[model samples]
Target: MNKNQDYEIFPDKFRIIMTGTTFAFFAIAIGAITLLRTNFVWKILAVIFAVLFMIAAVRIFKELWVKTPAYVINATGVTDNTQKVPVVVPWAEMMKIEMVPNNAVMQIGILAQKTVTSQTEKTHVLTKNLFTNGNMAFYSVMIDGFKYSKKHFLAIFEELQRQGVQHNPKILVSGYNVGREK
Candidate 1:
């Protein structure tokens, strides 16, 4: 695909399937909880789990219903359309692109000249605590194995590097096994 051309990334089928399974499991759990023997603590726990599970299911359903592109890449920059307020990262603001290894999964980290802003920025911080070790405010894009294999993601990453270089010769692009320590 041409780097200058716009491309829309959709969520993987595996994610949708897993989300459906989770919703079904939670729905069943709610039913099972009502049938459990009398126990105050168990009932309280059930209520908490029910609420959390329902929220998760609703969020997943909303994502499925919206059918919006997860990410958009073009000549100007990359836009994350998945957030409440899409984040537009201009090419000049992109400092570096690194592939960070995490629990056998690799994520593409887009380091920016300054912190990127989004409506869900705070949510990113909370989720980052689970996936990253550093405190930097770069944007992280997870490549779903079911949607795009590792090789495919790497290719896109390389293309992004090429685009960045074409747009801004000084921008640093690394982490494609070049052995530059992070």
Candidate 2:
């Protein structure tokens, strides 16, 4: 495969700040729970929340420590290296390419002509359901502002269009609107 360009979705200053804040919140919550004299049910809930938040904090910390490219878009296809098992979506199999607004960030959604398999499917039914979005099968790639600006992201989309894939202009516009609204 001819790898044309490589891009790294590095965490921006905003992301770093958010991650630090979340971690601090969780740490404080855990400490408060420990110090407070609560009922059994409340204690259990506190433990659960603490564990979940700790996990999330650890994940974010790992990402921050390990700086790697989240994805690699090549001449033939795009490969997602973020997951344990890399997902490679070939250009020929791409049915649609559009911008999807997610949590104040614009993500590039690549829908395949057929069902694309990934490591998540082997884990649980719920995971597969969440990833597939109940039949609308596609992969979402976050375009980090630190790594790529809107113009660069759009240029990449234009290049994909040149490869014969058509994107939904409405979706793209809506994504931009969402960014503006935020």
Candidate 3:
């Protein structure tokens, strides 16, 4: 690989990885609900869990779908297609970037702003406060349309670090679907 060449890691295998893991989990949860629905007392719990699983599955599907080119990353900053608007994180203000697990386990950082429902409107969902992220320092930017997980992601972050990105890298994530995967 040429040092001068700008490498764009596309999460080449992520789609396959997640489809098997996340989507499968959701399907299994749905299956469990079906299997347990026969029990009168447990039926309600099964139904609820199944619903939650289905919701999660749909989210995973949404996350895995990609309609853009490679994840554009460079010395200046990184850009993502998931973001509705363009986000430019200047290298000067760049802070540390790390990969984290998403879902309830850990807070998702460096990803698109999550959507929230509006309390004022009974039938409408509004954007939840995106600025107030969870206590967790960084969120793992989910890269879709891949067939695997570890390789490309690992390489991207290592490259960023090699380029001297420090922790809490000064980031400006004010965009529609911007994110990074390192």
Candidate 4:
């Protein structure tokens, strides 16, 4: 038996699958929206958004395709195979991890950049992915009335909390969006 088989459990498959399916649905939705709406500006925007959404959906599906069989081994530290962030997070740092509700609200900080008006410097800025999952694992960032079955949200949150507790770390718990709240 593989020594790491214990921690070799898969990531949140349902979320991955749901996200992929939703993106594909969105691709269709935008096309229909454009058809129903007669504004030229809206048409142009819809087509652009649809194309970009399709491309991103394809990319996400491809990544998940290969990552399904992967696992999160937690022998000394937790190594998440499914997520793209730091695969291996030491127990200490993981304990310090906290989720900021409405994280995109932090982007409001960027607007301040306009007021700074720095003319001589450039810095690498990571823009929020407005169209992506909206960081669903922490549901407060979700759009209003966005729905997910209770089981789905419970499963993911519990797993993360389980891991956090197992390694003697703390997990950040936040409220869900109004319509999506348990």
Candidate 5:
């Protein structure tokens, strides 16, 4: 158990910046390429997609500028601030924590006794029985390009689950090829 009960995981700014820049680049490239086309409907569709991507890029950059922790776990609960719809599930509500692999990404899926929602909004509970199909989670954190290693992040949660909280929620290891981590 760590001396400090609170664990805060910040996003890697460099990676975030790169991702945002890529989105922006694509938006510009797509819009520019479509300008050469004569089809009016195609141009409209391309412009819409470019605008959407630009919006996403702007949001990402804004989040990076804010510099908030992507994930936080403490004696009280686990808070996921990765998405626009932030969710905080207390230890008592959390039933299981699992490592769900989706392609090249490893996501920390927090399964609660019920659907966990944001303070204001009612977010959907996204899972189907132990997450066998790897559909979604009540709350999931993508562990790609974060400052810490996947093993370290998982270890922190495991330690917190064992020593920090009282409910003793199970932390299960799922998915294939779990040992590999960079």
Candidate 6:
């Protein structure tokens, strides 16, 4: 593909839907089972947990209904649409691309130039407290439901860097080679 060609990555709706539904189901089961407990504290705690899980499930399922590309990469920059507000990181301002693994989920963190913090001051959920090396980033997309494997995902950015795309930020991938299949 040409350097100017745009690539869009959409979330896997099926996997995400199933996960959301499973969480909802577990929440219901927990709430129901707690009814059998004699302790009031246990019941209250279980109810709270159930509500929180259900809320999370609802949010997760919303992703299934909203059909939008999570990430768009092109010659100009990488646009992250995963958050409420789209974050546009131009290649020149992109300082680093860090692949951080958390709880079996892989999140791609796009660290842009420190000056970009002015844009991140917005009240978006992803714009808060995302500090790395005294730099704030608003781009973090989860790849759990993506179609490509983790290795392929990393390769995409690496290839762009190798091709010497504009600025070509440093790509750092961690916790990917540990017991993970290609």
Query: By lDDT, who's the top model here?
Result: 1
* Residue 102 alpha-carbon offset, candidate 4, angstroms: 7.5
Q: Which segments of candidate 6 are over 4 A away from where they belong?
A: 1-4, 100-103, 115-152, 155-182
Cα lDDT of all candidates, in order?
0.64, 0.55, 0.46, 0.45, 0.62, 0.61
Query: Which residues of candidate 3, in runs, are more than 4 Å off?
Result: 1-6, 12-22, 33-38, 80-84, 95-148, 162-182
Q: Over 4 Å off in model 5, which ranges?
A: 34-37, 82-86, 114-123, 126-176, 179-182
Query: Which 10 consecutive residues of model 3 have the lowest summed lDDT?
Result: 122-131
Model 4: pairs clashing at backbone N, Cα or C within 3 Å: none
| TM-score of every model versus the real structure | 0.70, 0.61, 0.49, 0.46, 0.66, 0.66
- What lDDT is obtained when candidate 4 is compared to the true structure? 0.45
lDDT of 4 by residue, 46-148 (tens): 8888888888778757755564434343545444453343244455454233323343221100011121123331121122224333533311112211122
lDDT comparing candidate 5 with the true structure:
0.62
Better of 3 and 6 by TM-score: 6
lDDT of 2 at 110: 65
Candidate 1 lDDT by residue in tens digits, 80-173: 6745667677887877766666555566667666444465865764476344534433454333333355555666677777777887777777
lDDT (10s digit) by residue, model 3, range 35-143: 6437766767666776777666676555445556445566654554445544444455444344444332222234323322344631221222222233334232333
Hey, what RMSD does candidate 5 come out at?
Answer: 5.0
| Clashing residue pairs for model 1 | none
Best by TM-score: 1
Residue 110 displacement in candidate 3 (angstroms): 8.7
